[model samples]
Target: MLFTQAKGRNVIALTTAESLATVTGIAIAPAPARIAAVRVKTRGPGTQVTWNDVHSFGPDAVTVRTPDTIQGDQDTTAPTDKHHDPIGKRLLTETGQNLGSLDDIDFDETTGHIKRLIMAGQDIPGERLLGAGTYAIAVAAP
Candidate 1:
């Protein structure tokens, strides 16, 4: 399992499920001898819940021993790859305002991949505020 940051949020993946349903297939594969399941763990001050490794394979069945008990399952949901805005593409605001163009992306330093866009906007005095609020900055797409 792998833990990554996407859009300033943590993304959990058993395997790279970017395309072709990659992670889902591997998770349901026949259990290996030593490796039972893949567990995705999030570590940091802002994240939540930690435990010993969890098996990726689903349990056959379960029955509650005590009354008023609940059962929960954990699995990594696939990442969104809409690709509406291609890399280096320019996107405008809903109000038809020239917000900015996509610059580069900032990835998790530990993971070494893109996490957020490094948008560069026009050099207006007040415009900096707009850029600061945006995950995508307004700059010439390169």
Candidate 2:
């Protein structure tokens, strides 16, 4: 699913099917290129859970093993210092070629792996993603 579309999905517990929070954002880590954590809105400051804690990423909701899986905001930091925001970051190639601006990321919710990168008129495969910094998202040249 598109990360953008999954933003509002409910975060629930698998055993009880209880809704814990609403998905607000996702933090991704580069290098291996996978989701590091899922940020959500709870009654408190905020909450997040690591990808390993995620039991399933279904169409309706994301499931976790238990409520204990959720972590407070203090434990959830930026996926990395360089990549703060996933949406609207400028896109650039490793060779310094400009692609465009990032629109949304196509990711496999279950595995937390990116599948594609969406832009104005191009849909670049996720494997092309190299890294992202505050300034721009870098992709490898084809």
Candidate 3:
């Protein structure tokens, strides 16, 4: 059994099922290999997601880089100054009121764009708050 390291955190196998077998040792099997580029695609607080390796043996793994955090584009005005945190620690109402804190955010699967902002509220609305799509979210802090 032999292995080679590619890029920064990837391993290239030199035998049939080698990569898949290696991955299986840790968890599940790997997907077939394809010639393409590897990228993180998108990132948020506590999480750094990866996209189709274009060269991996599995359907990209959304590795959890950190915990208790969310990711979104900055430069857009939040409900308030508190809503201008990278990890989203504050929650603002459409009427300029502090409702609760931000728990996490969700994104569109295929596009890797923001979908919703999960707030840490209880009696206000659903556990999962809705978003106005990426256009509504900017990577800038308020």
Question: Number of the top candidate by TM-score?
Answer: 2
What TM-score goes with each of the models?
0.23, 0.84, 0.29
Per-residue lDDT tens digits for candidate 2, residues 1-142, read 8988888899988878788898887676676677788878877554788888899998888899888888875665545222466788888999999988999988887788888889999998887878866788888888
For candidate 3, report its TM-score. 0.29
Better of 1 and 3 by TM-score: 3
- By lDDT, who's the top model here? 2
Better of 2 and 3 by TM-score: 2
Q: What is the clash count for each candidate, in the order shown?
A: 9, 0, 13
CA shift at 73, candidate 1, in angstroms?
Answer: 22
Candidate 3: where are CA atoms >4 Å away? Answer: 1-85, 122-142
1 or 2, greater by lDDT: 2
Q: Superposing every Cα of model 2 onto the true structure, what RMSD results?
A: 2.6
Better model by TM-score: candidate 1 vs candidate 2: 2
- Each prediction's Cα lDDT score? 0.25, 0.81, 0.27
Off by over 4 Å in 1: 1-82, 110-116, 120-142
Model 2, runs deviating above 4 Å: 73-83
